[model samples]
Target: MYVGQGGLIMTEVVGMVFIIIGIPFFLSGTIGLLRLPDIYTRLHALTKADNVGLGFVILGLAIQATSWLEVAKLFLIWFLVLVASATSCHLVADAALRRNIKPWTKE
Candidate 1:
């Protein structure tokens, strides 16, 4: 029930679809973070998987944005978060490695 444009209905539907798709990625990331054996694996789950989840969420929101500028800004925010997450993950993994933290193995 949007106010201005009738097109808003389609936009809202698409946004909701994207958000629904993202939920499972977030769920799996959370499960992996909790169930994984070690810091490295947990970081992988949180950084890689969760970033994708957030990306989908962001994309969904972006699709509902009123203007091209808003869409660009949303994607820019996603990119910044992605870069920061990857950098932090690498730094943390490096620190763990330097401190002699071993990775988990199934064996």
Candidate 2:
């Protein structure tokens, strides 16, 4: 609705650029997940890359947000997802270790 202002247009363009930049990170993460040889490495690729991608996307959305409250909420969601992904990755790796799953290595 706030589409008439020049500032709003600039912000929207910047936000779109951020989102476009983030897409490759997501693609690389997907590629790594498929190409990597083992669970640990796959998890590393997905969690780290995807987290950064999502962060950029969220940052872009926040930039275009109409209000401070919405911006804050977007950042909060990003932080929560960041923490959750790290925790879940750690748990999965730990479980794999406990079960004695070997990490794939180049010989």
Candidate 3:
């Protein structure tokens, strides 16, 4: 049935799907952080989770937003998150390298 002028029911369904997909990425990242054997590997998990999880969350929010202003705000927030997370991760990795943290070597 039609829920609203802008198809609220469909939008809500898509938003739910996006949120559900994002949850798995977040969970996988957490697991990686706990289980990975090295700092580099852990960084991989963090980056993947940060990008995918934020992307999905933002997409879901955008789908549900009824106004262009709200959607633009959501996009701006996502962009900021992406930049911040990537830059922070890079700095952390560089610091670890400078401190001589040993990387995993294939034996």
Clashing pairs in 3: none
Clashes of each: 0, 0, 0
Clashing residue pairs found in predicted model 2? none
TM-score of 3: 0.88
lDDT per residue for candidate 3 within 9-95, as digits (tens), equals 888889989978888888889999999999988999998786888899889989988899999999999888888888988999999
The lDDT ranking, best first, is 2, 1, 3
lDDT (CA) per prediction = 0.92, 0.94, 0.88
Q: What lDDT score goes with residue 13 in model 3?
A: 88
Per-residue lDDT of 39 in model 2: 99
Candidate 1 clash pair list: none
- Candidate numbers sorted by TM-score from highest down: 2, 1, 3
Q: Which ten residues in a row have the lowest lDDT in candidate 2?
A: 1-10
Off by over 4 Å in 3: 1-6
Better model by lDDT, 1 or 2?
Answer: 2
Q: What's the TM-score of each model vs. the native?
A: 0.90, 0.94, 0.88
Model 1's lDDT to the true fold? 0.92
Top candidate on lDDT is: 2
| Residue range with the least summed lDDT across 10 consecutive positions in model 3 | 1-10
Give residue 24's lDDT in candidate 2 (0 to 100).
93
